[model samples]
Target: MGRFITVEPGINIFVEDINPAGRKTIFFIHGWPLNHNQFEYQYDVLPAMGYRCVSMDWRGYGNSDKPITGYGFDRLADDLRIVVGALQLKDFTLAGHSTGGAIAIRYMARHQGFGVNKLVLIDAAAPSSVDKQTANEFITATLNDRPNMLHNLTNMFFFQLITGPFANWFMQMGLQAAGYATAAIMATLRDENVYSELQKIVVPTLIVHGVHDKIVPFAKGQETSKLIKGSQLVPFQYSGHGPFWEERERFNQLLIQFVG
Candidate 1:
């Protein structure tokens, strides 16, 4: 079960601690349009491996308060700093997925005090201009009707493989529980350039990507791995954008080794 703590006014972050005695703290940041619950597999398994695992819903994405102003990478990084300070987390590992990866890089670049020792980027978007022409083509092709495209784009993270009544129920619950401020903030995040900040990170890093990922692609991960000194890249053969979800066991083992 997760415990709730107020990280800011009108915003309480939900966290679950599996083992307090663990030497290091692992903070998992979820990607866009998904809540902390997306990391349920990690939350369930990592604690037994002797690591204190903590995952929080980003502002507007999970149970946290979603305000219109707190969606940009800068604000999200600040919020992460606040939460780390609140918990007095030190010598911790920061792992982010997609947009969450961008936010983590920004936090490491700007904050000078936190002892973030390791970083893991899962199919993350690098801080470069996503081929504007390609983005436009994708938007045009996928969204024949702009209005309908908007709705689909909003829920693009959820895979169609998850079907039946449960999928419907899950989507309803996720949409209702997520904050409107999240959507507004997400719009601003789509404009961020995180590639420039990569060199500023001095910590040991790991870049994991799905070879078959259609969203972010393998080249982004390869480029990101090259930019960060001493960072290792792990590819999930049959996975797509969400390698952690698609290859949970392998992902967990790799993370454990990296954390050690």
Candidate 2:
């Protein structure tokens, strides 16, 4: 169900392809510093419901080869395009979370939404969501002390009370990534503006955001929805940055409803 795919000559991306026989397909992209493992909760349920869930650990994260370069949105989005072509994925629902959502925005514009029928943005960081100053501070923390930075990240990740062990597990995923890749992604979040990219999304789009999200505030979600014409915005009342985990059941239901 999982394998390493050669996205380029030397770069291989880890892909978790499940339930290949399912009627519908969902291609997932994880957020900053996380991997496909972040979608564990969704993967547990979606496949059983006749959904073919596919996720990849983009370069420098998870089981993927961590090259120092190609961390920018252009290269990242190109990697996605290559993967889609390699997988022969067509008419699939493209879903992205946080920074992944920003990359997804770039993909829509850069590749003309290639092979994508529907789009889903989960607590996406986009359209100038975070200012330059905060990004610089976060980059400083990531470079100087990644462990503590990830620890603090976990604290902001959820509104629900997660067990200590669960938090540790989440932090471990971030640790698996390369330090440069992690910091480079934050720099992308800082320097890149995806407002024009958002306007280019022409597919049926869904925006799911946590009302209490401190990382990428609820207002960004609201603003994102407005930018994408005809996009639907749904708020998770009891979630933080990670609505998919904090209010998982509701999140799963919303995904099912939206994808349907």
Candidate 3:
């Protein structure tokens, strides 16, 4: 856990910066209904390997301020911009997972990735309607019972191991997110189209997808790779939605290699 810095008046963003001032910085944007903890494995391992890891719990998730609104990509990208400027980071890898992937894409497209060196997408939610499980299911489950939905989704799709401790920990992370924010984000993802903007990003990009990812299909990763010029796609054959957790060592090493 690191300090909570106020990026806006009443909106403080929680950031965990590991091995500060290390060789290079990697700013990690976590998945939907999740936060900095989603990259706990990466933050712990990469820093010791001489690469600084910066993970932020988006404004309504984890230890950050949970307001009633501001769940779209425009605000999320600005939040990331402010966080990067606050840390005075430059030439850093901007990585995102799932919904965070969509946010990263928008950031590059809209903000033109001012301080970013490269891009990484992990089990990313696609621009169009590539989510196989469908947003309707998520909306229904969230509206019905968001907490229980996380438990069920975690056990059924999130991980390959599906052990008691791992699933339980993931569920806890998902539950901590603000319900209003989660609901609003889902709706935005459901209606918004990021496909048209992918061509706008010209930075060196990497797409990492678990082959068994049920939530966001591996084909979507392929599609995204096709859309971006000179982008590379890596696969974790044995993992699920979370390769950083399911295949921690390989994921970290691949990231290091990509940035190096």
Q: Candidate 1 at residue 194, lDDT?
A: 85
Lowest lDDT 10-mer window, candidate 2? 126-135
Instruction: Tell me the whole-model lDDT of each prediction, alpha carbons only.
Output: 0.73, 0.92, 0.85
The deviation in Å at residue 129 for candidate 2 is: 4.2
**Candidate 2: where is the Cα deviation over 4 Å?**
none
Sort by TM-score, top down from the best: 2, 3, 1
lDDT of the structure predicted as candidate 1: 0.73
Of the candidates numbered 1 and 2, which has the greater lDDT value?
Answer: 2
lDDT of candidate 2 over 93-180, digit per residue (tens): 9999999999899999999999999999999988775688988888999999999999999998899899999999999999999998
In the range 1-260, model 3's lDDT, one tens digit per residue, is 49887878999999898889699989899988787887878867788889999989988899999988888788888898888888888999999998899989888888888888899988878757434257767888888899888887886565466678877788888888888777778887887758987888899999999998887888899999999999999989988888888888899889989989
Score candidate 3 by lDDT. Answer: 0.85
Badly placed stretches (over 4 Å) of model 3 are 129-133
Better of 1 and 3 by TM-score: 3
Give the per-residue lDDT of model 1 (tens digit) for 114-135: 7698899988877563455655
